[model samples]
Target chain A: MFGDLTVDDNLRLGAWQLSGRGRSRRKQRDTSWVYELLPDLVRVRARKAGGLSGGQQQMVAVGRALMSRPEVLVIDELSLGLAPLIVADLAEHLTELNREQGTAVVLIEQNARLALDLCSRAYVLEAGRIAAEGDSAELAASPDIARAYLGEAQGLPSPPDAQDDPGPDDPGPDDPGPDDPGPDDPGPDDRGSADSGSHDRATADPAPTPGTAKTARGNQDTTVQSARAATREAK
Target chain B: MSDFLVYLITGLGTGCGIALIGSGLVLIHRVTRVVNFAQGTFAVVGALTAISLLDTGLPHGLAELLGVAVAAVVGLLFGVIAIGRRGTSPQAALVVTLGLGILAYAVEVMLWGDQGRSSEGLSGAVTVFGARIQTHYLLIIGVTMAVFAAMAALFGRTDAGKALSACSSNPYAARVVGISVTRMGLIAFAIGGALGGLAGVLLAPMNSVAFDSDVALIINGFAAAVVGSMHHIGRTLAGALFLGVAEAMVAGYGSATYQTVVALGLVLALMIGQAARTHSVVAEAG
Candidate 1:
């Protein structure tokens, strides 16, 4: 029933006890009906069912079950290992069958996104038990819903707030002070800074306001001092 | 030139027998994928049975008819036993048919002994284009032609034939469509056996009838079928004709002892043809 038989043969094998006349009629009707749903199968109608692709074989298997005119169709892992596009196509047909034929379809799938999209209502199973139940949209948006149904991990803390941090006005040790020595100002340990400090005062006092000059001088001396410290560290 | 014509006529006669046997082989192979090695044995058994019955005071036609009927029944039995038991393993079925061939031949040897027996030809003769062809040869040709025509009609124009073809193509699908593959297999075997019996009846008068005579006929028939690729009936007939003509040419131009060598060479050529086709299939797959 599962292997080597053609699609039509598989169907006939399932319904063998029917009267010969009735069997042929049923077979023809089923063939046309199945072809209508999955037109690609029409080409391989005479081909062995075992030789078809995974998706086509699945359709044949489903078609065999349908030939019995079963009230309920139970398909396990409808999207298992199938390409997304093929899964979507199969899902559309299943939905059509469900709506028009009133054939109840139980589709089990691992792709939560696809399952949620196709199914009207779904049960999220965890460890073999129902963990949650709801409509698709509600399930898609819930935080806990997102975590469980969408397979996202729960219980991770959020990052700290950006608005409450200290303002940029406060300075650290790197900032220049008003009393900071000029380049030519004599230092406790005299270097070239003592010579450069008088020259700066001479050029600065007449050129700009004294306070602005003093701040400018202090900034320059601090920069030079930092450079000296960096060079010493390198050496 | 007269000698050449004689060789050609002889080749044609032998080719007719080979054609009949090859067609039957193809029929069975198409449906069940097994080349029934016992096909020739069935033929011999049927012919010997007819001869034995004639010796017992039965009318010749009645004995022949009874022989054909018995052969058909034997085919049905072989179908039931060999095909039913082995299913889809063509190789296993081939081996089983080989064993059955041995069994049938041994039984014939036990009943008739190893001596050669001559039987009467069908009847009458006619001059065809200045060649005095025997009435039996005409009968063989006419009967084989009719069989081929009937087979073409059966397979081409009948519902039963289509169903059988479906079963052969895909047993599962055939089963699903409500065809009983087992029943179809039986039909194939019966047809093949009946054809084999017909070939034996045609050839029995021309050659010495013995227990081991069927082996050569079966081998030649199988070789012809293989040479034709076993798919086309026309090709199969052509292969039989080719083999027959080659054998006759060898017998005429070379020593009679070289006949076996010619046959062996023909078989080797067929095998090489099959091997070459198989290599192409592998290359395509790769």
Candidate 2:
């Protein structure tokens, strides 16, 4: 998003692909659906994105992505530098997007607990390799994952973990493989949601794990943000 | 008093012309971070092309339009050579533009020869508060005002304007949103050339253009643009006008030879002052 641009301007830029050619006139300039997804942006859309609060800026980011009406949303660090309350609000919006719009989310995060909570299936990594890949619940409960990552990642310094932020040229791995072949349909609203979390630039990444891994079930529009795991899912 | 008015008004005309060029520099610098030395060459191309078209019996307006279009194409070529590659640094692009500007001189001289060209624009004088000035100067002022007003409206009120601005605001984010930074930079260069061309065509009546005339034009224009840090249109306008009127005043009251010295002096003084200020601002904590 352009920091100098108003929230409105930033959101409109997301629709650049649709607005260029002979697209339908109705969808060309429309941003009403984006406003609906993030209702709080209505009043402040006229304000510059740089001036907004971190949470509001995050909303603008998510709203801008939603403007593309994309099937998948990839975020580098959703909760970075944001307050916990704001993260919860953003998490709920991500869930709403996944539930209401069926937008698949790829959340690259250092917080293992947050990632496991939102995803139906997860791949836990150690030393640039997937130590475990299966149902999110089983991985969360596993002692290896708990001791290696989930339990120890809380408020701790960054361990030897893979970085987020997808490189366009080399995005790492595309598939974590169909090893477990877990549920694509977890529950009524158990579709993937990225609970906004951040690897704060000011503070160190709090991952206690050795590294990161990425895994995706669906075939289209998978955006991997992990340095190691990015090679697979991005294709 | 009328003598002073003549200098002031004429100076303002000169100022408006320089402002047009300065605005072009501002736009290109804002988007691409390239200090386009070829900016004044754009004006030269526009003026020369207009002259050639006029010789072909094209109407004045049509000739000017074609001239500006040709200049815009030249600007696109500049962008292609300067920043077409992904890894070209801004400094490298700047040097490339300087070389391209010099290269353009050869092409221009080969095509037009070494003669100055001028067109009698809006012939006759308009009387103002006891001072009679050419009607062409007023046209220059009017056109410049209209251009600036249009620019303000485009950047401030329109979505396309905002998108153009966004290319410089946060390039990475702009890319993530699918705004092509490279394409936008090219558009900026084209617009810059067109603006420079417009300035040149308008200025042809005031100052006859020779093949090498852009050397002085760019010097003055770069001075005015530097006053605004080459990124702000409003400041560039103020700077251009200040230098333009000051030059006129110097020529009127003192020596015409000292006129260009003012431009050079301003740039030198401003750079030293900024460097000194930067040094003073720097502090080390143990």
Candidate 3:
């Protein structure tokens, strides 16, 4: 295969010659469709492949594999060296493929957040062994599972449904403080509504703040530790 | 006027060989993403092989064919060795190609004993427009034209051509479609090597063959490739012709030592062009 060939020609080479399926016509159509999805590739189709950016090269590699119409698609590292936005877009597309085509994709990724978000079920492999396995939600909520795959220092948040339930507020028969209103004072419906609203706020408010605070604190701690270490070395 | 025409013809002849080598370098870079420093060595090896066979009383045509075949094998070996290792850094691969070039030069020195050998003229001179020109020049023009035409047809009219094109544009997509990148790389190297060999054979009669000639030829070829952006063969050929003419004119008008300086200036110009374009792209992206 010549490197100087047009994009369509290159696609056809992998299509007809590599697969030996004799789908030259279909391959051309497929290439056009691919161009529709990745329009930037169209302008550069006539351009040499070596002149393309790293992301574009990754797209070409993925497109070439798609031409074979395989049941199982295995991408070595989906997020490797790509910008975050492009990786997110690619992950979204892969999810669509999974939903529409039922294609089983084996995506090996070093980014745990991406993997957990994209896959319905996952196995966390550490040192080539399955350290943990469960549904995304279950594993996310499991503290033990999080500690194993993700470091304890990772400070991963619990899943949305894993929040603590509010206990019933019972007023004792003997006495009540002025600030503490009796349960019957507000009526059952008002009391119930207020209780639910407060519960929602209590659960949602601290969740995000703690995560951010943890990150900020971690950064500060690292900076302090490094400074201390430098001072010690100087001494 | 006649003298100018004679120099033009000579430049064109040299340009043909440079274009072939430049195009080969571009092709290898397209597929493997490495600037092969060994390309000149491959050319020299091809020339030496042909010379050895010719010295043994073999026909020139047969000797040339064997030389091309050997060069193809060498190219295949290079592709396998340099590109086969998964995750080989581009810098490491370039260093390896340079090493291979040195190795090839050493082998040539061992075989031919570092002596300058002149080849017999390729079918004598031909008269064109009242000026004497070598038939070899016409051969070079004809061969280069034919090869470019064939490449255009292959790339524009064939399936394998499209696959290669796609591979270059987006390797990941190509792989997802099941293109064997390694196989494509091998094919790219073989074709590149064959072209380099052809250039060597075409150039053998024009200059004295020596082990060290590889470095200059490879440098010139790389410069040509860069000047053309390693894309269009026609542009690469045009660039080579331009360089050849400029070099000849400089040699005629000034000291020969200035030719290297001129060539260096051309390289600097091309690099500046590349950097400016890259800077603009960054700005646009921002």
Candidate 4:
């Protein structure tokens, strides 16, 4: 809808039908308020919206939505096709708006890192099913979550056991143990057991990466064998 | 040279009428995404209603106003049926508009019969540099100018216009912002219908307007809009003027039967030219 309309007019249209106050007062309050939030828009108020950059247009889109004083604002793909810096700036505004206005904001984003960072609670939808849902921090710390998103859990230190199990019926006993190999080892008396213990730990965890050694063949598989040998030799 | 001036001045009258209708077409299409083949039905209906009212001894201006109002209401109804619901596909809506136009034509024929209708326009002719011009032609030109000025002001300076433009630009976003896109489409239809009605009144006296005559006006108007890519208002007006002048010249120097052919040919040539220009720009970018 970016025609030859001036940016000011485009913004005004966002709240055009909203009536209760005097026309001039409403115009002054709503438009100037938008300008206050998006200061960059103020400089280009007289310019046509059609000539604006994609980022600017997106800002206008958000500004326009805000003018309506919506109870719940839903934004789709807040980061899609946008620069990282721009997305960050927009996220800042969204946070500010949510805090100040008590506006419920629902953001749909493909960038998991940004989404998990910005939201207090998040849901991960896979094939229309919610695969995961919880406090953002809790979800981020889960070993399975880490394995799925942040790479192998063995590389990172296991956090405190606060992540909610996916369900009551499926309590994953060995899932967290692999990440805490020091605590999970049966005993220190048998030095040879450490190598077999690591092997057992890798097998117990279903994650493909650390378990790849048992399944693969060729030069890469030999390297893995040598790495295990080296670990055993060091022990 | 004087003969050329006469033809040009005469051409402007027809050009103004076509431009007004073209503007309505563009506005409706922009808002509703429907070509609205029934758009010219407004003109025919308005003219016939006004003519009928005039025969009953009503004031000419009042009759014209009422006619335009009738057309606007009719347009609003059309919009509701064609575009009100969310689930109706745009293609389906376009077909509905076409069906409505056909229905209007049949209804007009049944009501007013096949006889062409005419009105008594302002009779005085003004001579300028040896070219005698009808006062009605001047009125048409003046009225069209006024309408364009009003439209520009509405679109450029007003909140309502901006809302309308917003609906046209991004209906989903407009709805998200609480603008009723369906209502905007209805408003577009209303304004578009009024313009079409006004065009019919301006052109009715010059030609005996009948039920089927709207097709020619719609064709010329649609052709004019195509010259401007169906979006630019100023360009559409200029395109209409150019088409009118060229058609008049062909009528003056060649056979009257070639007028429709010339209009269609001009549209094709302009389309080809625009397509080539677009291709070249794309080629450069590539």
What does DockQ give for each predicted structure?
A: 0.02, 0.20, 0.08, 0.12
Stretches of candidate 3 exceeding 4 Å from the true structure: A1-18, A21-67, A71-235, B253-257
Model 3 - which docking category?
incorrect
User: Which one wins on lDDT?
Assistant: 2
Put down candidate 3 lDDT per residue, A1-235, tens digits, no spaces.
1234444554444344333344756544467755655555788787654345545555554554444443555554555455555566666666766666565666655545455656777666644556666776666557764443344533344322211112112222221211122211321121111101110011112121100111111233432332343233223
Docking class of 4: incorrect
Q: Rank the candidates by TM-score, best first.
A: 2, 4, 1, 3
State which candidate has the highest DockQ: 2
By the DockQ metric, which is better: model 1 or model 2?
2
Give one digit per residue, the lDDT tens place, for model 2 in B125-144: 98999999989999999999
lDDT of 3 at A199: 8
TM-score: which candidate is best? Answer: 2
TM-score of chain A of each: 0.57, 0.62, 0.56, 0.61
Q: Taking the tens digit of each residue's C-alpha lDDT, what string does model 3 give over B1-286?
A: 6667667787777878888889889888876677888888778878888888889999978998888888888888887788878667657888888888888777788888798775665778877677788888888888888988888776667666665655564454344344555687778888888888888887888887788888778877888888878766667888887777777667656767897579658877987998899899889867
C-alpha root-mean-square deviation, candidate 2: 10.7
List per-prediction Cα lDDT, in the order shown. Answer: 0.63, 0.72, 0.62, 0.69
What overall lDDT, based on C-alpha atoms, would model 4 receive against the true structure?
0.69
After superposition of all CA atoms, the RMSD between model 1 and the true structure is: 28.8
| lDDT, residue B178, model 3 | 46
